[model samples]
Target: MMTTVVWLRRDLRLIDNPALYHAARRGPVIPLYILDEQEDMGGASCWWLHHSLRALQGQFQSFDCPLILRRGDALSILQELIRDSGADALYWNRLYEPRTIQRDREVKTTLQAEGLEVKTFNSSLLNEPWEVQTGQGGPYKVFTPYWRQAGGQITAKQTLPVRDLGSQDRETASDDLRDWALLPAKPDWSGGLAWRWTPGEKGALDRFDRFLEQRLQLYADKRDFPAVGAISGLSPHLHFGEISVRDIWNRLGHFEDVAGVETSVAKFRSELGWREFSSHLLYHFPEIPEKPFRSQFSVFPWQEDEALLTRWQQGRTGYPFVDAGMRELWQTGFMHNRVRMVVASFLTKNLLIPWQKGAEWFRDTLVDADLASNSASWQWVAGCGADAAPYFRIFNPVTQGQKFDPQGKYIRKWVPELRDLDGDEIHTPWKVAKERTGNYPDPVVDLSVSRERALAAYKSIK
Candidate 1:
């Protein structure tokens, strides 16, 4: 009997999965998931990984397909699987991170060298990061122009349907899921995470459906408010590829009852463009993880304050909004996108810490912490990334809090100390007599003074 091996990676779901669809078309596919111990999947990420894999396993069992798990380097594991299973072909979806790209290239080359048929398909984003470019034929350095070009080329025709796989011979020798230990061993810190998400393809689709029916209509206006459930909390799901961008796109296309359907769809599509831009940036400038994107930023003086970084990470920073964001990130594996920008700004601009330090923290804390988005967004706030915000544009946390979380509900939920405070007073609790406490601490740095210092530092670089 003809046989093919479908290697599951980031694209975990069976529905609308191009790699799985193609593999099923070729022959009876042996579904495989290899846990590569050599790769350092971050701490917070491991929590999400465990849950996502559990969901996938349940889905596979329903279909009578065995998910064979193995531990080793991917190349060696795949080679052995192919040799032993007598699989004629191997298939997987693409990943855009720099290291993943390098690994995939080597794996494909090695597999091809061994006379094995290896195929990859695009199931992650609507467009591959390399497909979009600027007028000069290079990757676009900025987001707006890149997004416009991408939108112009984007069409509904590109989304493919999920292909059904016929029954295949069941294989034994599958490793027990418990042996992987993908979850935390002792003193499980996942209590907070449990309150936040349900990881799976079905959960992802349910979220999308709910958002489309209720929240997406107000997405443009309400997405920034942390207290409101206006934004689609799909980043973790998207990162894990439980749902495809094409699937999301098709769902949006079906909305006919909304008044400004086109505008809403356009805005949401632009957000996906941002995802593409981040990946494109990482592809071109792989060193961005360690070095600044702008050459001048290499000389930009950053303060060495591990204590301050600790305060930021532990959510002890005196700024209520900044602290709220950090705490929210700690409690849940996700943070509101607007709050993310604010906290990042506070770190690089107000605290004078290096963007890399903050990026590393987010990489460790965020369940959806993607290499491209996390690094690019941090660098953007730090004024050292491609198409980054201007160096002089630092966010004033108190004002930002008042503007975004006007009712103080978001701040209250995450920061219990400020829960009883009302309105704008919640943002600057020190001004209130009863609220002020020696225990609570004062603002770490005066906003005006720090902004001036940051501007001067950038000016010196220029």
Candidate 2:
């Protein structure tokens, strides 16, 4: 009997998985997952990884396939598996992160050299990052034109169905999931993550179905509201390839009103486009994870305030909205998209801190923390990325809170100190009488003065 190895990476799901489908077609497939610590697994990322792998294991068992786990460099582990299993072919879906891309390239070269048939499929995004480019043959720096071109190329009719695999499970050596310890041990801080997501293909499909049934119509208007379940909270699922972008695009075809459907679909699709844009930027400019994409940002002075950063991370920044968003992230491993932008701006602009600091924090904390999204978004807020928000457009935390969380319900939920304050008082608790019994902290910085300072620093770079 022919033998094949299906090496799982970011795409952990069984349904609609291209690699697993193709592997089963060729021969009896051995499912494999590698836990490589040398590769950077940020704090919150580790938490998600642990749960995601566990979920994948459950799915594999249902299919009667044993998921073999190994810890080391992927190339070494794969070679060892190949030698032991005597697999004729190896297959996996593509990954877009810089380090992942590099690692895959090296692995493919080495494997092919050893005469093993190696194959990869684009299962992460609707379109490959390199496939879309500007008319000038360069990658797009701005979102609008890139999104337009991407939308024009993608059609609902083109989506591939989830290939079915016959009962062709192969025997393999597997490891205990707990031995990997992808989660924290001593502190066991992942209790928050358990409340946030189901972390598998089943969860992704459920979210998609619910969004189409209930929330897709009002996505454009209600997405900005943190308190409402207006937006599709599928970033982590998308990041892990639990669901495909094509799956989402095809499902949105039911809405008939052209204007409303187009508006909502266009907005939702653009977010997926943003994911592509981030990968494209990272691909063309791999240095962005460490340095600014724009050269001038190197000269832009950034403050070094570990104390303030700690306050921000701990959700003690004294700004209700900022503290609320940070606390939301801490407790749930997720934050609203608008608040993500606001908190990013507060870190880079208000605190005069470097975007790298904020990016690293998000990387360490966010369940959906993606290299492309986290790095690009932070740089965008810092005005140092491609087509970034103007640096002078520093977010006024007070105005932002009053605008988005107008009722202050979101603030009160996360910032318990201000829980007793009424809607009008919760947003600006400093203005409330001290005797009112709300134990809210004062403003961390003078907003008006800090805004001016941020503008001046931005002007110096310009």
Candidate 3:
């Protein structure tokens, strides 16, 4: 039997995994995971990965096959694995990140030159970034036109089932999961993450199912309200490829014709489209992760204050809404999308901090801190990305809190210091009497002053 080595990266799930499925059909499959040192994984991402791999490891073990774990240079390890197992073929799903793309291409070329049938598949995205194009046959800078074409092109690709491994058991030297040190140690800051998330395929499926059963109907109406639990909460799972985008897209097809679901389904799918758009933006413009997509914003005057940035990061921005979002992220490895915008705006505009600094902080803190999505989102909020919000459209943290988090439910949940205040006082604790405002810090920067500063900075670049 021809042994084919399957290199696993972000696509950790067994279902609908193209590379794994095709490799299994060919012959005996040796599943291998390499910890490429070049890849930059955040702390929360590492926490999720640790649990996700543990779950996948159990699934593979059920087939009596070892999910080989090795760390170091991917090319060197693949060459060594090929030699050891006498594998004549290499298979892997494509990753769109800039560094991974270059690395995978080089690996494919080198291995193919050595007479290996190396193949790659698109298991991560519903469509490859290049598949959808404008009429001019160029990439899209705007989302509405992009999703209009891209969404129509989507098909209901059937998810593959877990097939019999056919006695394909291979024993290889594997690195212990604990040795990876993916979880925090001395500080052990992941207590909340452990309580909040279940990082695996089963977890992903369960969340999606719950979203469909309960939240789907109200999703369009209440999705923007931070206090309402109407979100799918599948972002981290999607980022990790614990669930296939195709699978989600396929499942949504069943709800297309259902009454009252059309609007919600469209809204949800557009979110998926946004994920695709972010990837599309990153692939066509690789520098987006590091530099502004809109070049004119390159010279935008941005404040350099670590003290201010740290306050924003630690959820002590003195803006209740922004602080709540930050605190929620720290506690749960996630945040409400509405709050995300408010907090991001407070960072880049209200505080006059650079968007890159906020992006870096999120990339380190968020479980779903994808390179493309994180960078794109920060840029969008900072008015420096393709089709980004206008510079003058600043999010007043107090007004945002009043609008999305009415009654202060979301804020009170995260910002305990402001829990005692009622009415609009919760949104602006500084306005309340000092006795009522506990130890919550004063407004770090006056909102009015910062808004004008941000505008002036944008004018400088313009």
Candidate 4:
């Protein structure tokens, strides 16, 4: 029987995985995962990776195939693996990160040159970034048009059911995953993460099923409330490709006649669209991660206050909602979507901290730290990206907390210091009597003054 090698990356699942599925069609397959160091992979993501890979290894074992783990240059590993296993063909799902795209292209060229049939399939996105375009034959800079055009071209359809990669006799050695040092060892910071998520294909499906059955109906109404927790919590799963967009899309169902269900489903689909738009933005404008998409913001003044930044990072920013969000991110490796925007606004607008710095912090801390989404989102909140939020629409932390976490459940859960404050005092502890206030820090910056300062700064750039 022919031997084929399947390279795994973000696409980690057995079900709905195009690469492993197609490879199984031809003959016996070897599954391999390479820890590519060149990518901007961060610690929490690395922590997630270790567990997810461990889960995936179990998945492959159930199929009677072993997953080979390697750490180093992917091309070098692939070449060595091919020679070692006598594998004549290789398959993998595609990655859209700019550097990854470049690396994969070069690897594909070399593999084809060596007479090894290399096939790559799209398993991550609803539509490949390149497939969608505007009327001007250029990439879309605006989200609505991009979504409309792209949405029309793609359908929620999954391919044939999985046929496992049957056992192969060839023995291939793989590096021990523990030796890679991907997880935190001394002073382990991942205990909270362990509590929050299960790491592989099974986990992704479990989370999706839980959301679809219980939460999808009320998602539209409840998602904005930080206390209610209507989120699918699937970002890291989507980023790692433990589940495919199409699979989730199809599972949400066509629900055409159902009123409330349709609204919630549509909202969720739009979120998926935003994710697609982020990838599309990254594809068309490669510099989005490094530079402002709107060039005028290059000269915009940003604060260089390390002390304040430390406060922000440590979730002592003196604003309950922002602090709660930051603390939640630090402890759980995730944050609520609405609160994320509030924190981003607080950093970039109110404090005048650079968006890049906040983005980097999120990258290191968040399990769902996707470069495309993180970078685009930071820019979006900073009002310096394509179709970005208006600069003057600064979020007042006090009002935001009062509005979303009206009962203070979310704030109390994450920021424990302010737990006893009752009513609106939880949102603005400084407003209450000094004796009633515990040790919660004072407001970092006066809201009105900061708003004026931010607006004036924006005007200078304009």
Candidate 5:
């Protein structure tokens, strides 16, 4: 009689999933996913979700619990399911996105009013956004203190090995995956995406293992280099909650054989801390997605050029490094973290476009696009966010490309038009012979002139 409904969201993995674990304790469980328009999973993300859900469905099937997929209002569907199944309890892991928070709170209130046993737990963040705060009882805006506080307070709990939940029968109809239209149609642009990523719990674990075995040792030193291939590339995994940060944290400490285990662990944890910081920032300042955190930036002159934005999106900005990053993003639904900053800087600074515009584009393209992370990062690059890099430190694209993708291998891979150009010539193809440059476009704007323009704009605002 104690059937429980487990509402699944970003936390797709079954292991160490507090919601799934607790729900499994209460007799038979009805696992569910309800997709709605509120969370606009863009083209690339949708493709990943389709595959990830398929993988997740298989996992649930092995446990004899079908992950019922429904496309509509979550509240209405859950209520109907509850009525039909007579489920007495409901549980879910927390989501911190502002709109999602409001939606969940309303859902919880409505469900609790209906006399259901409702409970929510932290399965997403190592430290829940509210849990980590300042001495004055406020959220920490700066990262270092927040990181120190969070790291000191956080500990990984043991994962739930298995749950002995039995099968549940429900007459409620579920939507077919294909009907959801969570994939591209007409042309299927996800071909490159398919070749690059594997998006599920198993995939997350495998990627994490690879990162640990190969890249973790040099992650601190080489992570900023686009060509280094030292990063974990686990953003999409973390975004979808295929693996928990705590799981990642625990595994990060398993580098005893490496010489600089402590150093590497610290560096990697700092990166995770930055993720936590983004979540924390979003929780406190919900306006990050739309408004600049720094108030003065509200009046900053921004170019509203769709044509320029199109060029930027299509990797024809003619700045080889920026182009490579944009192309990589377009092709694989990911860009190296360093190149992300460089391209973002190029957009919000050099081009003087609104950060929100770039943020929107990323939201539509990135498989790993979490609202908080995307907004926070774009604003940081634009110097309009909390604890952002100073505006004066504009990234020189050619120098950045030369420094990071020094041998231009990363550039060559993504921007093949300049692939034949030797060394640094790959970073500035416009400077190369027209025949050698092939069809690569000229730089959209003079780098030095644009830098000065951006600086002047910043100075005027300041």
Candidate 6:
């Protein structure tokens, strides 16, 4: 019987995993996970990865298959595994990140030359990044047109998890999970993350099921409110590929016939489409992660103030809404989407800081820190990306807080310093008595002055 080694990366789960499914059918399957330095993650992401691997390791135990853990160069590791395990075939899912794409290509070529059967499949995206193209057969730069084309091609196509894995009892040498040190040690700042998240395949499925049953109908109307529990909260799971997008897409169809759910379902699906669009943008424009998509903005004036950036990151920007979002991210490793926009806008425009700085901070702090989404979103807010928001469209943090978080429930929960303030004052505690506001600092920058500065900077480039 043929022996196939299944290399796992972002696709951590077994359900609807194409590479694992196909490899299981052929013969005995060996599951492998390698921690290549090229794909390093932040503190929060590492914490989640540790638990995710532990959960997956337990699942594979049922089939008596050890999830081989190794760290170092992926090519050398794979070659060593092939030679040692006597495995004749290798199977894995595709990752679209620029560095991973190059690494996978090298691994595939070298293994194929050595006469080992190497195969890869897409297990994350509903559509491959290149599959959806414009009328001229080029990549899409705008989202609405892109989704209009891409959304049409999606179907309720589903793949099942491997149900029949032939036993492989060989005790191959494997690195201990503790050696990876993916979890924090000295400081151990992941207490809040533990309270907020359950990072595994079962957790992802449970969250989705809850959304479908109770919150799907309210998603469109209530998703903007930071305090509301209307979101699917599947982003971190999706980033780690704990659940398949195809499965989520197919499951949403089950509620299509339910009355008054059309708008909510469509809204929720489009958010997924945005996730696809981010991948599409990154694949086509690999330089976007490091540079501006709109070349004219390359020379745009941006201040380099470490103190200001630190204030923003610490949620001490003095704008209650922006501070609330930042604090929430620090505490939970996630932020509400609407508040993300407002905070991003404030950093890029109001604070005159570079968007790249904001992106880097988010990458380090967010559990769902995806390169594509982080890069694309920062650029969009900075007015330097494909189909970006206009430069003059500055988001007033005070008004944004008042509008989205009307009762200040979201703000109070995250920014407790101002929790005692009255209804209207919660969004702008600087307006109330200084003693009552406690240590909540005053506005870091005069919004009026900074707005003009940002506009002048844009004018210089234009």
Q: Compared with the true structure, what per-residue lDDT tens digits does model 4 show for residues 1-462?
A: 788899999998888888888899999999999998877778899999999999998888888788999999999999999998899999999988789889999999999999999999999889999999888789999899999898789876755477968787767898999998889988899999999989888899899989888888879899999778688999999999898888888877756348778989888999999999999999889999989999999999998899989999999988889999999998999999999999999999999999999999999999999989998999999999988999989988888888888989999998787788886778888887767656778888999999999999999989
Off by over 4 Å in 4: 254-256
**TM-scores, each model vs. reference:** 0.96, 0.96, 0.98, 0.98, 0.98, 0.99
Query: Which regions in candidate 2 have their CA more than 4 angstroms from the true location?
Result: 157-170, 256-261
List candidate 3 stretches off by more than 4 Å: none
Model 5: lDDT of residue 58:
93
lDDT of each: 0.84, 0.84, 0.90, 0.90, 0.89, 0.92
lDDT of 6 at 34: 95
Better of 4 and 6 by TM-score: 6
Q: Summarize candidate 1's per-residue lDDT along 1-462 as a digit string, tens digits.
A: 668888898898988888888888776778888887866677788888888888888887777777788887899889888888888888999887777889899999999999989899988877777888777888889888888888777767555555555466545467777787767768788889887788888889898888888888888787888888888888989998999888787777776446766566768877888888888888888988889999999999999998899999988888889999999998887899999999999999988899999998888889898888888899999999999999999999999999998999998888887777788688987787763433565777888999999988889989
Q: lDDT: which is higher, 4 or 6?
A: 6
List clashing residue pairs in candidate 5: none
lDDT of 5 by residue, 82-103 (tens): 8888999999999898889999
lDDT-better candidate, 3 vs 5 = 3
lDDT of 3 by residue, 1-462 (tens): 888899999999999999989988888788899988778888999999999999999999988777989999999999998998888999999999888999999999999999999999999887899999999999999999999999888877778987655455456778898899989999999999999899999999999999999999999899999888999999999998999899898898899889999899999999998999999999999998889989998888777999998899999988889998999999888989998999899988988888888888898889999998998899999999988999899999988888888899998999987888996789888888988878899989998998998898888888
User: Candidate 2 residues 1-462, lDDT tens each?
Assistant: 677788888888876678888888876778888886767767778888887888888877776666778878899889988988888899999887777888999999999999999999987777788888899988899988988887687755455444434344335576788887778878888888887788888888999889887888889888998988789999999888788777777777656456665678778878888988888888888889999989999999899999989888988887999999999998888999999999989988889989899988888888888898888888898999998998888888888999999999899889877877888888777788887635566777888888899988888888
User: Ten residues in a row with the worst lDDT in model 4?
Assistant: 251-260
Q: Is candidate 2 or candidate 6 better by TM-score?
A: 6
Residue pairs with backbone atoms closer than 3 Å in model 1 (clashes): none
Task: Give candidate 6 regions above 4 Å deviation.
Answer: none
Candidate 2: minimum summed lDDT over ten consecutive residues — where? 161-170
For this target, which candidate reaches the highest lDDT against the unseen true structure? 6
